[model samples]
Target chain A: MKFAIQINEGPYQHQASDSAYQFTRAALAKGHEIFRVFLYHDGVNNATRLAVPPQDDRNITQQWTKLQKEHELDLVVCIAAAQRRGLLDEDEAKRQGKDANNIAEGFRISGLGQLIEAGIEADRLVVFGD
Target chain B: MAKKFLFVNRKAPYGTIYALESLEVVLISAAFEQVVSLVFMDDGVYELTKGQKTDAIGMKNFSPTYSALGDYEIKNIYIEKESLDARGLTLDDLQHLVWEDEDDDWAEKDSIHLVSSKELATIMADQEVIITF
Candidate 1:
């Protein structure tokens, strides 16, 4: 089975991102294919490279980046939501005339269309949020 | 077969980014040509209420975007009647949303359906995919 995941909350503030991560990992362990993971709303913050956790704590952004690298996952951040919350990639930051870009590795900025496509293409669409 | 996609909105507008972000997904889902329906329940009913002014709050008022859902071929928009009553609102308080019915002599038809919570639950059960925000 192919699964598509939607994350709607940011890290630390909500358990949504963690639950989504666990679910994805478990699905992959069971040999299920992950179609895509589309971030929206506060979830876009999960893709920011600027997030830094304490030495003892687990870094959420790094977890996602690692998962993407190992699984070759399609991790997408909604462009509109990212713009509203200031999570920009290099191209978007330059286009918007910003000084810096913070999008983490393995995640690309895209539109909500990717989300809808995931719903249509994946066998199951799982959403985690507030 | 096109899957029945039901977007469940339980949050209020503006207080959080959920409402606005959910609308973006709904609009984009139209392009997939899926059987999409939106249910406004709980605080989500406030999303459809009229006369919203966000300039005072310094946030862009995106309420007008609800009216454009019809243009995207999304016609099954349901509002929980209990939610509206609990919030002291009625159909008159919401923006008038309509779509052109090609099967009905091309007449304009109201798109918003006032349904009870029970009815909304049944509608939810029939959906192949249910995304809540």
Candidate 2:
């Protein structure tokens, strides 16, 4: 099966971000294909390149980057949500006349249409959030 | 018929408009003759509790609205077991017969299903479309 995951909750408030990762790993282990991972609402925080977790904790950003690199997953961060939360990529920061980029490399800022597209293409669309 | 996964009630059914708006969408989807199923998870599960006293909140206790689902022939209602357990509720405490256990024998219920998180994932995987609140 091909899966498209929708992660809506933020990193701090809920366990959704971690759940998405866990589900992704499980789906991959099952030998299922992943179409994309769409990050909306607080899930956009997972795409931040500047996230610094405590020394004793796991780094979600780094984990996501590694997973994407290994599997070539499409990590899509909603552009509308990212802009509202001050998570900007290089192109968006330049377009909005910002000083620097904040989004990680493996992630791309995109529109909700990509979400629609994911739904159309993938056999399964799993949503993780509150 | 196309199986449309209509996610009704996203909010707590009081504070935010997401829940009500989602209901409208679900009704619309059902009107199209699509096979719709509803899952109440997270704060959205509050919408299912019976005998809600919304008077203090200056709002109508919309929990009764669930009873009207039968009128629309929208019988595929599913509630997360963990959600009800967290709130200290049972299936009898709800306005409608929601599933208490994911693997609970629901063959007796009329078009109603009780699903665990894992079952919900499988159902979601098989659906043609999903619209979250």
Candidate 3:
């Protein structure tokens, strides 16, 4: 089965991101194909490269990036939500006249269309949020 | 073949980004040609109330966006009747949302449907995909 995951909350403040990560990992372990991982609302905060956790704590952003690198997963951060929360890629930052870009590696900023497409293409669309 | 897609909105607008962000997804889902249905329950019913002015709150008033769902060919919008009564609201307090059915000679139809929580639950259970925000 193919799964598309939607994360709606940021890290630390909520357990949504952690649950989504664990679910994705378990799905992969069971040999299921992850169609896409869409970040929306506060969930866009998970794609910021500027997130730095303490030495003992798990780096939520890094975990997502590593998963993407290993599985070649399609991780999409919603552009509208990202802009509202100030999570921008290099191209978007330059275009929006911002000084810096903080999008994490292996995540691309796209539109909500990607989310709708995921719902249509994936066998299941699992949403994690408050 | 259109897949059954249910958008479950359980959060209130303005206080959180879920309502607006979910609306964006609902609008875009039309392009996929899916059988989309929206249900507003709990505090989510507040999203459809009329005369929402965010000017005093300093938030962008996205309430008007709900009216545009009809333009996206999205007509199956269900509001939980129990939620409305609990909040002391009625259909008259909500905006007049309607859709024009092109296939039916452009007949104007009410987009909002009032259903019991049990009925909404049944509707949700029948969906192939259920997305909540």
Candidate 4:
């Protein structure tokens, strides 16, 4: 199966990020193909490279980074959501007159149109929300 | 072939417009002779609870709209079993009829299959379109 998952909420405030992670891993383990992982709304936080959780727990950012690296997943964070939340890539940071970018590696800031295209193209688009 | 479409509702009906908008979409899709299915998950399952008092919000209660699904031939309504159990709700308490995840009643209702999240994933993969609210 080919799937697209949408994450639409923040990490700390909701379990959406965790659910997305679990679902993605499970789908891949089942030999399913993940067409794309689109992050929108507050979900863009998952793409923030600056996020650091407590040492006692699993770091979702690092986990996602590993997933992206190992599986070559398309970690797409919505550009509008990223800008609003102050998460910028190096290019976007420079364009916005920022000193540095905080967006993590393996994640690219894109437009909502990509989400629409994935929704139209993918066999299934599962949404994870709070 | 009529397209099989599923609307996954994840929010409450009142506080946000997502629930209401989802209902509208289901109705519109049904009108087009599409096989529309509604799966209420998480907080969205609360939308079907009976005795809703929208009067506090100065709005008419819209739960009744769900009861009219039969008139529109949109009878495939499903609520996640885990969601209901987590919220301490039962099928009898909802405004409209809903089958549980393990319920065999769906088979009696024809091709409408009440399913678990695992089955939902497979069903979703089979569908032509899926929208999340």
The candidate maximizing TM-score is 3
User: Once model 1 is optimally superposed onto the true structure by TM-score, how far is the C-alpha of residue A101 displaced, in angstroms?
Assistant: 1.4
- i-RMSD values for every candidate model: 0.9, 5.3, 0.9, 6.1
Q: In model 2, where do residues sit more than 4 Å from their true spots?
A: B1-7, B12-127
Ranking by DockQ: 3, 1, 4, 2
lDDT string for model 2 (A60-129, tens) is: 8888899999899999997877887899988899999999899887989987667766766788888887
What is the C-alpha DockQ of each candidate?
Answer: 0.82, 0.08, 0.85, 0.10
Model 1, runs deviating above 4 Å: none
TM-score for chain B in model 3: 0.96
Q: Please write out the lDDT profile of model 3 over residues A10-125, one tens digit for every residue.
A: 99999999999999999999999999999998999999889779989999999999999999999999999999889999999899999999999999999999988888899999
Q: On residues B10-101, what C-alpha lDDT tens digit does candidate 1 reach at each position?
A: 99998987898789889888888899999999999999889999988999999999999988888999999999999899999999999888
Worst 10 residues of 3 chain A by lDDT: A46-55
- Per-model TM-score, in order, reads 0.95, 0.59, 0.96, 0.56
The order of the candidates by TM-score, greatest first, is 3, 1, 2, 4
Q: In model 1, how large is the Cα lDDT of residue B25?
A: 85
TM-score of 4: 0.56
- CAPRI grade, predicted model 4: incorrect
> Is 1 or 2 the stronger prediction by lDDT?
1
Per-residue lDDT of model 4, residues B1-133, tens digit only: 5667777888887887567755755665555666777788899889888888887788667788777666566667767778878888887677645333335553424223346777667767877777788
**How far out, in Å, is residue B68 in model 4?**
29
